[model samples]
Structures are given as C-alpha cells and as structure tokens.
Target: MRKLQFIILLQFSILLFAQENEMKWQEKQYPDSLEAVNKAPENHIILFENENLRLLKIFVAAQKSEPIHSHRWPAVMWVYQPSDYEQVFYTENEKAERIPVQTVAMKKNELPMNVGFPVGKGDLGLSKNLGNQDLVAYRLDFKKKIDSSKKITKPTGWTWNEDLDGVKKAPASHQIVFEDEYTRILHVVLSKGEEESVHTHQNPCLFWVVKSQPIEYSEFKMDKKGKLRKSKTHQLPPLPTDQLLDQNKISDPEPPHSVKNLGTENFEAYRIEFKK
Candidate 1:
C-alpha cells in the first residue's frame, strides 16, 4: 500500500512539472499583428514583403532595449554587427527568464565573422543590447508554412566556388555560409573597385546588405559561343546601412549581371537563396 501511494505521489509531481512548463510556453503569446515591420518600425523595417517571404532590417542601438514583440513565422537571422544581447521570456505567473543568445564565429578572407541563428515563432520578449556597439541584422521571415517534403536530406557543406560571377573570384571572400533543405546562404565581400564576375541568379533570393555602400551594376548576355556581350550599365543607388533587397521570380529571371564596388569601403552582403 505504501509503495503504491509513493508511486502516485511521484506521478503527481511529474504532472505538475509538465503543466508548469506548458504554462510558461503559453504565457509567451504570439502577437496579433502579422507584420512586425509595420508594427515596430523603429527597430524593424520592412525591406520587402510578398506572399512567400518578408525581409526585415533590424537595428538596435547600444544599451537599449526593444519592446515586447512576437514573431509568428519561422525566420533566419543574419547578424551583421553582433554584440552582447539577451532575450527575455515571460511567463503567465509574471516570472521571467533570460536566454543568452550568441552568434557563431566564422572566417571570411581570414577575418573573423559572426552570424545569427534560426528562430521559431513565439513571443521573443525584449531584446536588450548589452554591448557598446549598435546591433544590426536582417531577418528573413517565411510567410508560408514550411513544407516538410522539400527538406534537405543530406548534411549541408560549405564550399568556395571561383566560377561564380557578379563578385570577385576570391575563394576566401566568397563562400557558402549556411544551407538547408529549403534555403542556401552565401556570403560575399568585395573590396573597392573590385568587380564580381558576371553571373545569374536562378532562385528567388533575399539580398542582405551587411555593410552597405555604392555599387556599379552592369547587365550582359552570353553568346552561343560562351562570349560575354555587354548590354546595359547603371549605378545602383546606395542602400541604407542595413537593408534587404528581395528578388522574386518575376523580378529575377536568371539574367546574367555583374557588380562592382563604387564605394571607398568594402562591400559585404549575404544572399539567401530559397528552394521554394
């Protein structure tokens, strides 16, 4: 009898813990506003939005915090200027927990680089910048539900391809930073006056300007004999310090183009290519 009683007590305790955890998750509510960029324009700016994707540029000043906001869609964050930060999650019981999120460091052109992580839909609480430098990043929010059938089966690998165009052929500066079944992320850095080889983009993509600057754009065509023929040339207006340029099937028809750095500083960006 005593053994059975103890077993019942243990089960009750387990159930209570489970319920408490569930309540914590429930307390983190999703905001009704579907567009974060519109709702929180101070920190979140919508660079482009469509049926499939919503690209947002996020900036937070040093020693500041953003108000409570929720993300309803799964998104990938590309951190351009990472600093010390904390994400607070609240519970219905008025209890709060802090999660310390940090960016992973990688090497680009033998220089240290940092990148953000993928986030799921939930109440993300306040984002507090603890570091002295301002935080700048881009978030690629998917508007549609994730399709499980199209998920990547094999492990993603990083590679540096020289034949890629619209950027310099430096293997160290251009690399595949991240990849999954649904998306591929490419990191490119071009020095001043450096030209990217003529290349074509075949997939719908989000171009994130990490370190924004002026650029010269030129379109060209390849003959049947694999010779390049210049068609049009224009100067692309300087983008904001941190912005995202969305290109869809209608806008990007896989035409060959090249880009040259017209600014004095280095041009850096991340191109997120979507499989869908």
Candidate 2:
C-alpha cells in the first residue's frame, strides 16, 4: 500500500510540472486568441495593433474585476487613473493564487504609476479593484522579442525633476515615465504660451493624447537653433482626446523641431518608443 501511494504521488507531481511548463508563453506555443483584448474585450480596449506593438486601454471600475485573461508578451503599462486592486493568478489545475492587495493612486500634478511586466506563464487572471475609484491605464505590449543589444544605458542626468535626454532638452515638462530593455514610455505636457526645446525623436514613437480639449491650440514646424520662423508656424489641430496618433516607420525618426502651445488647456500625451 505504501509503495502504491508513493507511485501515485510521483505521477501527480509530474503532471503539475508539465502543466506549469506548458503554460509558459513561447513563440510557437501561444496564439493570438489568448490576448487580453480578445479574451476580455469589455475591459481591454485595443487602440492600435501591428506586428511589433499593440496599444490597449484598460478600464476597470470600482468594486469590479476583469475576466481571466493573458498578456502573452512583455509590456509596459502607464496608468493615468489608478485604484487599489488585488491580483489573482490561475494555476494549471484551475486553482486560484491570490496576490496581496496593492493600492495605486494617481495625482494630476504628479506622474502616473508606471509598471513593467515580463513575459510569464499564460496562467494570467483578473485584477479586482478594491478601491472606490476607477482604474484606467494604457498598456503597450511588445509583440516580438525586443533586442537586448539595443538597450539604452541610462543617461548621466536622467532624473524625475530633470531630463537630460537629447530628445527632451526642454525643462521638466517632458520626461521619461519608465524605461526597460523592452520599452520606453515618455510623458510630455506643455502649458499655454510654453514652448519645447528643439529636439527630435531618436526612435519610432507611438503617441497617444492623454489630456486635451478640442479647442486647444498648438503647432509644430521646423526650427533653427532656438529661433522660430514667427509666421511660419504651421498650426496642428489637436486630435480628439483618448485617440492614438499614428506615426510612420520604425527605422525613421522625427525631424528635430520645437512646439509652442498657444491655447488655454495644457497639451499632454504619452509617447512609447523603442530602442531597436
């Protein structure tokens, strides 16, 4: 009887190990159907998608939860509106593993809660919001393997209050929200009568307007050194709020220029860039 019981236990252990390995996301093992947008459409809104990236807007109201879903790729999540929440990860045998409650809050004057998620087993699950406030965030998924050889070493002066990046030569208005081997998230805000220093994107960037009004005024044109062609300012009509602004080419970057806000509302957006 003792030997039989031992054999049964060994079989169970082997099954658990196999299931754990099977759940890992791999280039050949996973399918697009398991993505959060496809599995939990109500809370995960797909804004834009391509072979390299997928931009999603996540919204979970207070006292609510998102359905079980999987994010098969590595990602960086920029949370503009945050709330306290708990995480529940499903196991291979359909058991629940509940993570401790985490509190997240965002302030208007301050930056949002920036997070980086690594590729893991596909046993992903829902996030239950414990706070009364709604949890809204933008998630950018890296659909392909990000080259580690192209990682950007943190510049000598990278800081929360000041950004020494060549692309963000202006004051603290434009800054890096988070940076990892996989992705870089930037935040830019320009108030009325304010202008950004002459700079250009070093990488292909996907931009999304976070806060703005239809009537807000802005313009981006060529600039020489610190000088602007006074009348040559080509006005850029503000895109509607919560919309993804598309850009072309992964190999191509934006030309160096400056932006002067000429409206009452502040110009705000998140820019997701890649090193490779």
Candidate 3:
C-alpha cells in the first residue's frame, strides 16, 4: 500500500512539472505581442490584461477574414453579439486544417455563455466570418498557472463583513462555469432590470466585461437575523467600460451588497477570483 501511494505521489508531481514547462513553452512560442490582437490588429482587440488573465474581443465584418494569427492561451469564449452566424477558421500553420463553416445558433436575446473552448493552439490560423451581420465575441484567457493543491476554506453562512460569500448566497447569477485550485471563474448574468440578492466576495477578482451595459451597485449591512440595515450605493459604468482595457475595473473584498442591471440588454461578465 505504501509503495502504491508513493508511485501515485510521484506521478502527480511529474504531471505538475510537465504542465509548468508546457505553459512556459506555450508563452514563449506565442508571446503576447504576437498574439491575435497584435498579429491581426484590426480584428482582435485587447480588452484588458493583468497577471491573472487577459480579455479581448474579435470583430470580423461580413464575409471578411482576420489575418492569420495565433492566441497563445486557451479561452472560454461566450456566445457572441448577434449570436447566430457562420464562421470558418483555417488552422494548423499552413491552414491545412480547414474547418467547416458551422452555424452558431442562439435564441433572441440569449446569452450563450459556455466554457472550456477556443482550443487547438490558436484555432491554429485565421478566421473568416461567413455571415452578413458584423460578428463580435469576447474571449478570455487565463494567464496564471493552474495549481493542483490550492483551496479556500468553504464558508457556511453570512456575517457582517465576514461570510455572505457570493457563490454560496447567490448561485443563480454568479454561475461558476470552471474552477481549479488556482482560480474560480463565474459566468455572471443579470437580465435587464434584475437585481441580485445581497452577497459578498471575499477574494480580489479580475473581471472580463462580456456585456457592455449600465449597473447600480449597493452595499449593505446584515443583522444577526439577516435583516438589512442602512447601506450605501453607487453607479458603475456600462461594463467593458470602453474599448480601452483600462476602463474596465476589477474588484477587491467589499461589504455585503447587491448589483442591479440598469440597462436595456442583459448584463454579462466573467468574474475570475484568485484563490492564491
């Protein structure tokens, strides 16, 4: 039994070392400067970037193709604006891996949020929008290395400036699509005029503003019985703040609060909380 356990432990350690090396190679081969935004400057735009993650958007007009480029890191891309369309990506360096144009469908006003995608070492090449409408999609890249043994002490309930965790108290809106030892990523959504129940985020977070719309944020105090006391409120800019990455802001631990969508369209954001 001890021998088996030792072998398993050794294998896990080897796996970690291999992952670390692969990530380093991936970055070197496809440095940020050569990535989609710079490689095809007109189409792929950088939305924001920090040590933890980077967010960007791709805009391809009807029947147009962005230059052959590469995105170093894998991404969890969301359903696009005017979501229904056809797109063909020619990949594999010489563009030998020709991808069949597939119809990406979505219902009216549907926010097609998804995870674990934009794969294959840069979609491998250039993208061509085979539709009439202008195509727009947000792509988020996780930059931090995924650790296998990090954790957060799971909270049980709410307390003043204490518990009241975001995911625990408000799971519907702050939907966690992916989580690992290093990070917890939530696909947060709020319909127009919808307001979330008060909750608190204990960790500092990096945000990818997927939907650009206005919002009203309010912070409050909770008594022992959970009744709300006097609070303060503020108005946040329409998300994605601007075409400029610096316009979008991140979050640090704050008091118990609620966020309400104050726009005509649904509000969407990728909230990446760092566990380290």
TM-score, per-candidate, Cα-based: 0.67, 0.67, 0.64
Between 1 and 3, whose TM-score is larger? 1
Give the clashing pairs for model 2.
Answer: none
- Sort by lDDT, top down from the best: 3, 1, 2
Score residue 118 of candidate 2 by CA lDDT.
32
lDDT of 3 by residue, 182-214 (tens): 666777899999999888887666666667778
lDDT of 2 by residue, 173-234 (tens): 66776676555778778877777775656556677777763332223443477443433346
Which residue pairs of candidate 1 clash? 152-181, 165-197, 166-196, 166-197, 167-196
Q: How much is 8 displaced in model 3, in angstroms? A: 29
Which residue pairs overlap in candidate 3's backbone? none
Q: What is the C-alpha lDDT of each candidate?
A: 0.62, 0.61, 0.62
- lDDT for 160 in candidate 1 is 19
Total backbone collisions for each predicted model: 5, 0, 0
Q: Once model 1 is optimally superposed onto the true structure by TM-score, how far is the C-alpha of residue 43 displaced, in angstroms?
A: 2.0
